[model samples]
Target: MMKKPGSWRQIVWLLIFTLLWGTTPAVGGLFSSLSTEKERELGEEFFLELNNNYPICTDPFVSSYINRLGHKLEAQLPPHPFKYRFYVLDDPSMNAFAVPGGYVFMNSGFIRLMDKEGELAGVLAHEISHIYARHMARMLDESKPVSIATLVGSLAAVLLGGPAAAALLVGSQAAGQAAMLKYSRDHEQEADDLGFKWLQKAGYDPRDMILAFKKLNKQRWYAGGQPPIYLSTHPHTDTRLVELANRLNMHADVLPKDHDNQEFQYFALKVDSLSGSPYQLLRRMTQAAIHEPNNPAYLYGKALALAKMDHPDEAMGALEQGLKLDPGNYFIRREMAIQYFERNRYQQALSLFQRLAQTQPHDETVLYYLGRIYQEQRQFADALSAMERVQSLNPAFVEVYQNLGTLYGEEGQLGLAHYYLGLHSLTSRALPTALFHFRKALVNLPLNDPHYARVKDQIARLEKMKVKVN
Candidate 1:
């Protein structure tokens, strides 16, 4: 069972971040934003941490399927300031958490526990409620002084006096770390109630919350020695089950109808069909399709299985059938575009993305890919235009910055190239790319160079910062 977080472990994490950031408040602020760039950096870091710290079973098809579900849920969510992104942690522990902003994380164990779509949707909606309600931000606000001080002090000590001071700084914060996780039982109940509502509004059965709890309760007895962590975070399962049942009964007339069992099965098949060894996946997918030829998701799964098996022609045909059945599915269109792009059919990919972007103007991904297609066609001007629009829409998208940098460098706009490359450092890939361009630009960068000098300093500072891996 999951208890309160360990004081010593929390201290170690705080000190690690402190040493990494060198106690610079400015740098701390830089990493603290709710933007996509910050989220990606934090997401990748947290993803790596959870994997290293926990047990997980990896399956690509399952991962993609969960993400697809998350995307659909996100689209249905009411507007919020933060960008919600979901990640499946490769951990067997049945636990989930929402970080600052809209990062909803789930372990593979949670995925394995999901027997029906509503159960999965219930979990997702629960996590999303935490995010929408700013639970993480509240946690941070309540815990920040200690957390940030420990973080800064550790880093400052490390930078000034090296490893010994860093160790001491970290050890100091180990005393009060448990205070961070003291969320009241009321907070848990509130999140649960709102989560149930969210699921209902999203066309899921409100009763799934109780069903999910029932599943966990059964697992607790069946697994004897070690009940899942999910049991720990979500306390009083029986009480919650009763509460959900009562609510469903009271609101029966207003509630969404029960979900389709066949639909849930189709959803599960989408993951199972593409998740294992390519040959195994292909065999399962083909057999499944033969048994359920009319299911669009099954056809799509077979396409994914074919793709994994390296049978592109077969995959293309399968994808066509799937698309014919579900024309409005952006995921299908996006995958089809990817296939065409891989085959050097730029025009076809461009056409599809263009239509998608027209309806989804704020979709930076579509815009980014559109820019890529233009660039591949040597339409630098058009490429620049598309990328520029994306930059305006989401400046934190470092890939767009990187693309712009490359275009500028190729076109001999050294000043522009340096600036763009420098901004690209804001992305999660804190690598040599930024420094490489900085060095190249230094030759042409005047002491008073507008873009080069400013960008160079940011790059230099970031280069000095270190990252601590958990």
Candidate 2:
């Protein structure tokens, strides 16, 4: 009656969903069906899961900067009322994908190759173009049954190979889907044209777009022994490069003048600071940069590289030094906050988080962490308030509901407790979380515990259901 969880039908739908949501676009064309709300929601959930699980790379600065860049590009895109969000995955793969709805994933490897803001803007703009054109929806239309097929194949791949091996095959299968969705040669050309146009709109170098592609092409070839899966998803490197060149030739005189990105120096420095290497090695890199004091970017990079391998006390000192030189450096503050959070100094972390919240009041991440700190301190009221803000900002945050349910259960508010607990049950996979909160309620309530009896029964039933599913 419950569909027996992970039944053949569920497996079939999962595969269909994965394929429908997994592949990249063909030439840059738009489809009408993506305009629908249900498809958009499904696409959003799929992408959010993909990103949460298999991020692109590991540097915080790159992830944050790309998300900023994405928002800027999204603001400049053609108006169609739908939720659009951009994220940089913590991966080193040199590729980008636009999922159903407007979710975009850019890899860190893409960010590392970027020298100018325009190149980064170009990449984001191209992905945005796919969303505006509804290219993913069109691809889904053509590959309808492929979703079911790909999903089944993916499940088989997973069952046969385990999750890790399944990931490898999934990437390849996704590339195959991308090849099939290839926008018309013309759509591809238009995307290049429009993407560069937006890069100029965003006040970045148009040529960087061309250069980024060339660098990717070279990287592909240089990776002789290992063929990068990224190349598999991308259009022909030579073709893309030529198209960019031809566009630049046509608009050579009219193109915006090359712009210098002061932020790029900060971005690069922030990334280098987080790399894993010996302190001596980092000190040497910093020493070389210190010798060339005229180059502020190099100086910043050296400071970051040093801080990465230095002790926490030393790292804080180095961060302060860099901040002294560049007083308005937001990245330094963010990085410092990260260091504090990592070191388990929640009091200091709370202070930094509060500061960031003032600037980014609606940031779910800031609220989530702020709430976490309060929870750690046993300030349940404050924790609930903070988490409530996050839930309001992004209602899809299932964990926030779980946390709120837990807080309510602890406070003996059974009505509020069960409401949030039921909300958590609808969205979360961790049975223990719900079970723990419900059990807390059971213990605290009246000995008669009418609500306790109901919850106890529900918990038992759910546990039995889980056992069957397993």
Window of ten residues with lowest summed lDDT in model 1: 154-163
Once fitted onto the true fold, the runs of candidate 1 whose alpha carbons sit more than 4 angstroms away are 1-93, 107-121, 132-184, 199-204, 209-225, 257-280, 320-334, 347-368, 384-401, 404-420, 429-470
TM-score of 2: 0.67
Model 2, 1-470: lDDT tens per residue? 00012333443444445455542211122332343653465454454334333423324335445566777777776677566666554444566666656677665556667777777777778877776776655665665344332422332333222223334344445435434554555656666777777777777667887777777777766777443444554556678787788878887777777766878757644543443333544665567656765444554455455455556776676667767777766656666776687689988989998898898776666777778788889998888888778766554344566788777767667765765775465344344565565565566567675565766764674464442221
C-alpha local distance difference test of each model: 0.60, 0.59
lDDT of 1 by residue, 295-336 (tens): 676666677778767788888898888888888766567668
Q: How far is candidate 2 from the true structure (C-alpha RMSD, Å)?
A: 9.2
Cα lDDT, model 1, residue 374? 89
- Score every model by TM-score: 0.63, 0.67
Checking candidate 1 for backbone clashes, the offending pairs are 18-155, 56-90
